[model samples]
Target: MSASHTHGDCCDHQDRHQFSLRKALIPIAVSALLFVIGLLFNKALNNTPYSVGEYAVLIPAYLISGWSVLITAGRNILRGRIFDENFLMAIATLGAIAIHELPEAVAVMLFFQIGELFQDYSVGRSRRSIKALLEVRPDTANLKLGDQVREVDPKSINIGDLILIRPGEKVPLDGEILSGQSQVDTSALTGESVPRTVVTGETVLSGMINQSGVLTVRVTKPFAESSISRILELVENASSKKANTEKFITRFARYYTPVVVVLSLAVAILPPLLIAGATQAEWTYRALVLLVISCPCGLVISIPLGYFGGVGGAAKRGILVKGSVFLDALAQVKTVVFDKTGTLTQGNFRVTDVISENGFTQSQLLALAAQVESQSNHPVAQSIRQAHGKSVHKSGVQEYEEIAGHGIIARIEERTVLAGNDRLLHRESIPHDVCIVEGTVTHLAVDGEYTGRIVIEDELKEDAIAAIQALHLQGIQTVMLTGDNQAVADRIAHTLGLDQYRAELLPEGKVAALEEILDRASHTQGKVAFVGDGINDAPVIARADVGMAMGGLGSDAAIETADVVIMTDAPSKVAEAIAIAQRTLQIVWQNIILAMTVKAIFIGLGAVGVATLWEAVFADVGVALLAIFNAGRILR
Candidate 1:
């Protein structure tokens, strides 16, 4: 007698469904058993019409099975909301009872309850699957407080606090490793299977598991701002931004139920009064059947479920779609614009070539350059040191100076060694053979004499070529935008077979270039998506039709401004996101067509008296279950 049903609010509905199955089973069983007894009693009475024994047995069964529907319908009517599945089922069954069809009335309510139970089970399973996919939020942290570790909630841990991460335990907060070494598993966040090794001075993020060795970490960010928290927040709130198809279905159902009710009333009243041979009882029976068939439960439940499945599926692949509306936009993207650094190319710089001059050997040139560049922490300097592959001792070095926007001037072992860009050489009047280089270059000078030049270039990611090819296969144009010189940009574009390239653009220039791309796209063509990871890429990312950020190495501004975050920092996932969106949309439309087709056929048959009340119940509940199952396919 305590049965209740919910219509809107997907989270509330899912919570109710998660627990409703067990509560509903006992009442349904009792109602079904009593209905069987009532049928046997009616048979014993030789098919008597309106028999007292039949009413006594079957009326209780009908009330027991349908008490929730009747009460909900009455409450909604009082609240001035009269059109829903509950109203439809209540009216149809009550009309059956009025026509002395006690068995049919009881059967309808019992079958409807059975359908509700199945729906509960289906939705609960989906909710559990999605929960399992996003179960990355760490529950506790081991706070290392002065030689004693205390188990505490991750949220209670503050910045600058020390935390001990044991082997096989998850890192509780984003922090730098102060001591110890470990191989950490980042699959929970990045969807990558390979374990990453971490040592002292390396930073580890939250939600990563420590595979081996203990790590003493100094926390940098609180739990609220951790990577895991941001991802969970995006997923939990994704349903709030529904797609256009979902919104349209919601509005369609609101008015659909009322129109069906009016049409059913006309079917019952107008036929008997207008036709000579049409009896009121027969036409009324058809009206009840029509009412039962007209419920829009399939469309109401399946559309949102489909989108929820899509979001969960994307999360599993290290792609975080902020909302279903963004998913829709991704499916229609015709052009994918990429930022050169850290997006298609690995942002890490490496020394590619070393050109020597002025009687300096390659080894001596690199060693001298590395010794001077060692005083700097720039990425280009780091690449030089890494290439030298030896530690530099500053013991005999003097007068270490860094020229902003130029290079470095340091006197090592009484030698004035200069390591910087061409501007530095030009400022010192040191003449060099090459005034311009294809890629990033650093010129070295000793005692104001040109010694050599080091060529450093950012390497393309391993999957960069494959990613562009995949997008091209989908008929999407691929473009690259960068501030690198024209030679470097042309080389990368030709190597990746990109459709276009724009070079030497500043941050604002990148935004203007994106706008021009947007302008060239016709309204009938698709949208433009921009993929980037740097702080400078934030503005253009926000301007794109669908902004995708490389979450693994992307700056905070880029991630916050992006509509979709690719956690793996793989350009290939851009194409994958579009594929998932297209698949979700396809399944959604299939469900819509399936539900509408079944309802139209059954509604017409019921009105013409060819379909009985039993068929109408099957048509309504059966289509809903099928659609629910179909929507769940996206999770797979």
Candidate 2:
């Protein structure tokens, strides 16, 4: 079948699995009742010629329970794909019937069907859990048109249109609140429990619930491009990118089933001829038991299910892992590198200190610097203007010139004012006593005389220190890279207790530095991960072993290039992501070892004639259910 058609069939099967528990029970109930009746009849007959009556009831019971398996096996045989679980089941039960072991044949098929029922129910429950975790898509929007409000599909609402959100309603689209105040619940998007108070001009994303007070919001993005839609799409497509372990299991199953089938055929024939004491009938029965026990249903289903559960669990914590492959990579990460601004720090600059010289008062220096730097859009310039707290009139400013890579030089009311870094001071032949400042310093020069400096700093994020400490506790190294000077980098690094810090590196230099970090981490050590949240960080984000992005306030380029997106924008989520990855891999391996060890022991027992057909059924289906339940534990 074509890929699309196969996917459609798979969906149909899942839909049936989701709702077919009651339907499935009916056939098994009837088959089980008939099997019981046939057993009683055979017991009462006790060597009479009326044994045909036992076959009469038991044949229908076996057919009812095993018909699907037999049909699927036959179809696969015609298509030259006979080595599968269904074929193993079909041949084992048919061999039992041929040897006149009617009760064992009926019992094997009946219990196998029961096992399949449990598997379906477990899988359906898992799918429902994941769906509930991510069911953030709003159904309708309350659109505000003129004086009237009308409900409409969220997809029909366009950007720039106003929408009214009542208390307890989910925000229909990404928008900014234009009026009113409310405490909005962001747990669905950020996995945070506390409701955030939002007011006029505050941006509200889709999937957030308004908790109190009616609000009017102007939509910023269409429904298709909203946060909820992107999250759904990311998770829905994650399974396509399988982990290496999942792929190995799949390849192993393909070769394993056929090899077991060949060995089973040899067991049926070679044993009777090679061993004089072995009877053909006894060896054939043992060969049938071996075939049933050797089915690889457990390993085939549980590995992928384990990874899927891991992804779902992480999503519940507001961490978006793009694929199982990334989760696997994250489990091996020994060092996490972070971009200083935005990722580790708040990226909001503020004037922290002001030093005066040449008899210039601190207030006077700040006012003059703010006025000169008014036209520049640099962050440091904005912080100075904010600290000054006054509007600059264009009439009082003239001859404004912005020196690239240096600072701003403007004529304020015909008095030359230079508000820039030390480079601008040196380039203009202005002398200053304080050449080196601890933090980001913007020097001021009034008419060839240096007038003190303003020290601005970016504060560390609230969770930065906690995040670093958590990584250290996990025995992973923490490092920071930034374009800021070494002094600022050292201060932030020391405050956070980071293992290493690289300062004053440009974007290209960050990539080169990352390459060195990767090289230093030998194959035996582990991979290196980079976390960043800027347009400049995209290249390094893409180059790292596992790239993480701060999605809440992160730039589009960085988010798009990242392998993992931390929606809460908390530095702490980085440690949580690694923890989740490691836990997921642990669960997956547990399932693998559990399935393999049980199968190996049971297969040996069946080949040596120590295990019956009933035990063989448990080996095939009982271990499968165990592994599936183990995989589902990740969701908990």
* Cα lDDT of model 1 by residue, 131-160, tens digit: 653565788999998989999999999999
TM-score of each: 0.85, 0.85
For candidate 2, write residues 498-550 as lDDT tens digits: 99899867667889999989998865578999998745588889999999988
Q: What's the C-alpha lDDT at position 415 in model 2?
A: 87
On TM-score, the candidate that comes out on top is: 2
Model 2 spans with C-alpha error above 4 angstroms: 1-12, 15-42, 45-52, 71-80, 353-454, 552-555
Predicted structure 2: clash tally: 0
- In the predicted model 1, the residue pairs found to clash are none
Q: Quick one: best lDDT, which candidate?
A: 1
The global C-alpha lDDT for each of the candidates, from Candidate 1 onward, is 0.83, 0.83
